[model samples]
Target: MKFFPINKEEMNKLGWKECDFIFVTGDAYVDHPSFGHAVITRLLESLGFKVGVIPQPNWRTIDDFTKLGKPRVAFLVSSGNIDSMVNHYTVNKKRRNTDVYSPGGKAGLRPDRADIVYCNKIREAYKDVPIILGGIEASLRRFAHYDYWDDKVRNSILVDSNANLLVFGMGEKQIIEIANLIAFGKNILDLKDIRGTCYITKDIEGLKDYIEMPSFEEVKSDKLQYNLAFKIQYQEQDAIKGKTLVQKHGNLYIVQNPPAFPLSQEELDFVYSLPYIRTYHPIYKKDGGIPALKEVEFSITSHRGCYGGCSFCAIHFHQGRVIQNRSKKSIIDEAVKLTTLPNFKGYIHDVGGPTANFRNPSCKMQIEHGVCKNRQCMHPTPCPNLEVNHDEYLDILQEIRKLPRVKKVFIRSGIRYDYLIYDKNTKFFEELVKHHISGQLKVAPEHVNDEVLFCMGKPSKKVYERFEKKYHELNKKLNLKQYLVPYLMSSHPGSDLSAAVELAEYIRDLGYNPEQVQDFYPTPGSLSTTIYYTGVNPITGKKVYVPKDPEEKKMQRALLQYRDPKNYELVYKALVKSGRTDLIGYSKKCLIAPKKIRR
Candidate 1:
């Protein structure tokens, strides 16, 4: 019910002379469970460990890192909930104007590559202290990942940050086990076997238990080897039957254990029930609070993990593909608790996780046999084993809507429409249209071209079309005018100028100008990014075209919003460049007129 210690004064109030762990972060302190730092620190505290936080420390100097003194256990480092480079720059690599994670939405509060910077600063403050890295930045970059900003493959972050250990995925289970080992007077090197943790060793001796990946030298120099290496590592991410993986970086070995098991409903409920203040620390009250907290303060994360394996997303590599949910009673408990907050205004902004429509594993078979490593649950075609149902999700929403002060409950975390359409029960779809949608229902069909969709690990555009039709029918039956807003992307790895034109035409047929267009950003650890860098699919090893030219990338993005008067020039150029000068005349079918507009 209270915030954790952030400074020496708060530590004094708690009567703590020294801490067990000092958590260093790249974000302003927001004591909400949604924030990685709060969840990890709270779970540690729940287990009777003293933890302190140094949020957005002055990494330029060692003074701020030593403020908490030395921790008896280890120093936990995270680059907030998002990667630092993605946080600081946009798709065009332009410096972003604001950072929601920082107080007052200010930019430049945290340095670039925050995990490495913060860990290095901690090392300067106290040499030989164990540093454990987690959070999105470290988790996805835990392997030899392609850094889009650097335009090359970099070694595992363990090598760069020099951290003693790295914990990927949701760290509740791993952190507990790690703390237990440390409490027993075990050395950091002795704690390598814990699931979800990665460690470095000078020699690969005694690592025969792990599945060895292609050596760093081979993967770095040969694109085919890199592709094969990623596919093997991707398959072993399953918590159940996965073998530990080992990869060589020069003479050193980076060994990663299988991911920790997903939290059971009872266990997940306990973590959410921890003492979360549900907002930014009051110390940031004067600077207008952290912008990130404003988005989720009223919202509830009812679950974790995602089944929708969009190639551009890092969720599977981090949260895994297995779905984990909080118990119904537990979710209702959180919803009721939300009504007590001072800012409550009759709305529960959202109630979902990675994929809102997903509440359970795709099928019962997933429990006995781990999710298919080679096949997706619902991409290309829905696997026969894929059981598409949404009754449990609908029930939870109906219960939350009945809460006294809760007037409306919206699902902004996004629903997998393809899966909804695959379900035989139209009841969930009907209820979603009638109750859940807030004027517009947002769904990501990413692109219209099936080739691009295949490369992105998304379902074909036809699936989205079917879902769109069903959505319209349901809204009509309910006498509502709800809209299905499709989230579209341009310049994805497989998309060339011709593919971009198809998407623009699809948007034209839909008769709506997208308020925003997502230019495919090749972030690290994404399947799409792998192809963008290597021009080969790690899974299929098929060559794919990538949009790397800046001008070509600009033209693809411009075509998505060709209807926008400002995009006229780029649209015209894209049409001409693609050898589609036929679309550049003053005809009804033409995207733009040959004559230049004032814009």
Candidate 2:
């Protein structure tokens, strides 16, 4: 079949009595590698299993979920590619007006806490079916976590969703192991020991070596205990040396086994070569055809996982720290395929993953031993053991650029400036400016204050300055007028009025008025969110100031775009509060004009 069956009639056309597995997702069915549901379902189909998909089913009733009937093996559930709450709401806790993952970019197609909602609906339809939860929502929320919407700590998603198994991380290996075990007549309760999975167990007597964290009740009531639990959970995410983790939720225990080993190069290549139609299902063509597919239809995921360890990013908690990249042949073959598509417009939107420049492990030692428990690879400073090379990646990009019918290839994903600067090789940088730039290069220098950068697990402001200066120099040498768009954030942990003012000054110095800015969103499973909730950094155990007041947050956000006329009053108030009123006067170096001078 060109596409997986979404209903029983399509299933029968394939001459199947019942599917081996049915995936329930909170997104419109787009059979692309970028979507988690597509990757998992396609892999299962490649393994000779009859897999089907039901996308964005109505959680308000069991009718939509029951249309697919029961699966012979299991029901795989996910909140699509991201956490449902993050997708449904904005940083200000307001309901988002549109969902790019839905048909026609419509909101309200899926309910909030989609993983739990979908699982509950499934249980109502089939009382005894095994439901395996995977994807970002299930992976990141598998442990007891602070929910921003709820404004309180909640039990592990496994506990709330009532799924028999929870597969975390990139689930290619874990899901296959699970399918084999279940197909071989093993019960869900008997499959607790599989790496990269979580299950509930009432007994821990047989589990010999595992780390126990604070219970759900303890984390809910005590902030210190919450931070401690997060620290323990974050440190043991490595696949090689990580141990089992157990967290108590009332009478039951949530047991997460060590992460599954990363896929070998050949294995990674095979997963991407699946026979995917690479667009939304035909059923969605009537409703404007799933807006999310447009962004990634022409793009390629060169690799998976990130070692940068930015505190606000959940990639570390979900994709893990180790880099599992595909072979150059696989990436190039995918690019060649894109050129043949009917919609191929000769432009490849992106040619990277979580971090564009990271194509290999941060260090060789991480392969034998796990990533360092207490330290990051490229934060505060790049580790001495770090291996900085971009030769293979550059070669792959060069080859893709020369492919037939492919006009331009851009690197839209993030590039870690600190890691790039450490390379000491100018070839990649020179080539990037000469070839890959798409008029404007977007990078993230969230804030300019060293204190804020430290809290964010990012490099110092000086590193960004060095990178900014060099980027312009390369562009100048190449005689290209490409602009550098630095992404800025406001009101993050450890950011006070003074820090906000300092960032405004940096913006002024750059002579760049940002058109877009981001507010630090306290999403679940991020170290920044933990710090926002607990008022302490889990890694350092030091108290950090958090801006909780709505007014102060508004002022901080206003400071980012202080040039806007609408933000004048907020910026004026912020400058006054920070004791930097000199920046409000009509001096040549001032950020704003004085109140009397405006008339």
Candidate 3:
């Protein structure tokens, strides 16, 4: 129930001369499973390994890196739960004012490019201590990819960080293998064949049956070459059918072994059942604790991996497109334990993962073969082999609702509405409207233009409309007044002013004002970001119009909130630019008035 040793004093209390592994991260140490560092450290500890953590180390100096001392095996470095660059700056490339992962919601607690910075500092202190990079930042940037902040392509993080290896995806499978081999008197350099890991090598003679991507120099200089490289990497992401991939950077080559296989049901359940303190370290209490833990503190991740292949999501790369779930008994046990916590408020914040309704693999073929290399399970239409059932999910929800102290078990995670609507039986939908919803159920429709959705790899707008109609009908039948809040986005690739007008008009007709809209952020490792950079779809090789101009992006964003008085001018400009000025007259259907009132 106590946290692992975090300082020399704590290590001394434990009577440890040296630790087996030291975990360095960019976030405040919260021993909750929601944090990546916590899961890896606790899992290693469960296996009888002495692991110490160095959270939020001062990268400017070597002092913090030396505190934990040298480890016997290796040092684990991660850029917290989010990529450091994405965490530090906004889509506009402006530095953000607040960081939720920091104590007291402060900013600038961790430096930019935290994984590279932390790794460099560790090398400065220990010289030869093995460094293993994991977490979202390293996983997404493991290959040569675009850097939105710098507006150019950058080398694979493995080259710049000088780490011995980079572990992509969920690292339970790879880390255990690495730790065991390294502990058994094996050198880190010889551990190159492990799946879900990448390493640098100068000799390519030993590599066989591997796909070689375009050299980093070619990809960085030519947009077409970049698209081809991205397309190849995108297709070969499956664990079952994937092959080792290699990309050259100068004389050295970055070789990525196939992704580690997804954990079985029993293994996945064990990961969640690990002894987690489920809160931030007590040392951070004086600063009012870490803001990131508050949302997940009361929540439970019922599963891992997502099948919904949205182009803008990093889950496809990090978690893979496979669905891994825990047994109902395991989830029920966690729900029972939640009631015993001192802060239990009769509400379990969530009972889902990447996508809530997905409780198993998308199809039987996926379990045996793997996800298709060329197509998504659910995109323009549901694959014929797709399994559309929510019975198991509904059963879990009903059981948790019957718990002794749990008054309401809400599902706060993103629920794929298209998948929900595809289920022929409406029993889950009916019950969801009746019991699970806490006044509002949010869904990500993203946008209403069919062409834009195609570019983003989302379902068409008609499918969303169908789901919305059914949701309202179910609510009416249940005698409840719950609402469906559709999440909207603006200025995604292929979304010109014309497409933005289509979405704005849909909002006008629906009479809903979005409180917030996510502009397309070109973070590394997403198909949408590739399109934004190359101006073409990587998969199809078709040219796409990207909204990169600052003024046009403003107008597109403002059109979503056109009802607000502050957005009048921008909306007017957007409508005029799109040649939709006829709709600007005095009419109920008009988005905005022809002219603003003179003050």
Candidate 4:
């Protein structure tokens, strides 16, 4: 038996190879951590199955499928993400809170492809390949969901991706079970017993009956119900298994597995323990661009998850609200490994995570008091979950810098200014400047408008200004060239022309013309997107402004990168039309005005 990975180029190059299984996908890029396809493919190879990876296949026609030949066992279908449509829509809809992807420029593409289109392409390509859909897109969209883009709920991707099976959440365990069952010669029909997967069928009435029986919605919405559901799903303790629902319709068999096991502390440890050979994009190989691997720097994960529940963000949904951390020793060892790499540079570290400055568990105290109710501490408001301590991080920083090969350490991740400002001592700040490799630190203030910032779960503009002032004062006293380069977002919900102009004014006052400005893309499963669709805060239930017009969105986005004269003219007209003349001559405000008038 052999395996085939079906993508256009690979299919053409290795046409019609006899294989036991085929893996099909639609991602041009590879080595993404979240996409377990790469690992699963490697694991199959290790098991002695002839496996092939089709990277970024054109799903436009059936010709693309015929090229891969046929497989003996099954065709594993994944689009890297759970559902391309969900990924595309959510990413496209998120407002540009930062200009990180600016170098790519405006490609003028839809944020995401709808699932129906992807499913149609799959149905056209491989009529009988036993398609299996898994990933965040498939997981969340497995059932009806609130679609922010369309402003209504939509059907599951299982109905759309045309796959034989849909696996949700982290696919490691489910994929492994799938491969093992196939290896044992159990047909897809006989393997519905496995947990942690969902499949589709024509028996819509049965499925509806099964779902309506107890209403997972009731269990899913309330915290206590959600936790009990999560425990039932993860723990899989037989005592909790209330009932099993099996629905069969026409050649399709839909099996919804009991939730798989949660990652125990040991399991979580194993995940981080995997040999993470971080590599740079081959495009950056020439200049030794991956600074950490080159020995010039080391990359460290400070913490994970963000408390700021931005509606368009997937981090909370995927990584969860609770922050998990590595022991200081684990981080220090990674730093030690950097020194051993060939042609090592003297830089000890560049530390960061989803949000740097967040160290340890955010709710240690809450756990101690046994009062922690929510998974996320920072949400709603910073909880008394854990002691907010920068010292643990500070100690790790100090330790890594002491290494002989380490000349300096840097914090490259965008610092949460609000968190840092709360630190009582300026020792961390002082050490940061004294040990700088680059004369700059990057931060994301996102937006200056109070309404926008509040919506983003960020500190007010005043807080960021205070941090900025302190940052500059420290740099001056230390006689360092290091400066704070802030990131800003544009065209988010609640940000009208006036709000955008206010942000532009703030940017100009900072004396920087950022080349990139991000327009918001609403990712699925974010609180922000929920608010975007409802025009009211999901948490607060207050009426809010959401810019619905395309022209208005474009003008708001232009406020960030108003270097081009055409953009300036358009923005100027927009601002004038909106009657925000008070922002016209402010240097920051001038981003949308003609250059000469500002001068």
lDDT of 4: 0.58
Model 2: residue 224 alpha-carbon error in angstroms: 0.8
479-539 per-residue lDDT for model 4 (tens digits): 8877677777877778888898777767667777787776776655555665565667645
Count of clashes in candidate 2: 0
Per-model lDDT: 0.89, 0.92, 0.92, 0.58
The TM-score values for the models, in the order shown, are: 0.98, 0.99, 0.99, 0.71
Better of 3 and 4 by TM-score: 3
In the range 1-599, model 2's lDDT, one tens digit per residue, is: 48888998998888988889999999999999999999999999888899989999978899988887889999999999878999999999999999999989999989899999999999999999999999999998999999999998888999999899999999999999899989889997799889999999999999979999999999999999999899988889988878999999999999999989989999999999998889999988889998889899999999988999899999888889999999999999999999999999999999899999999999999989889998889877888899999999999999999999999998888788888888899899999888888888889989999999999988998898899899999999999999999999999999999999999998998899999999999998899999999999988989999999999999999999999999999999999999998897777789999887454
Tell me how candidate 2 scores on lDDT: 0.92
lDDT of 4 at 208: 33
Colliding pairs, model 2: none
Say which prediction, candidate 2 or candidate 4, comes out ahead on lDDT.
2
lDDT of 3 at 507: 92
For 89-186, candidate 1 gives per-residue lDDT tens digits of 99999999999999999999899999999998888878899999999999999889888898878889999998999999999999999998997799
Cα displacement (angstroms), candidate 3, residue 28, comes to 0.8
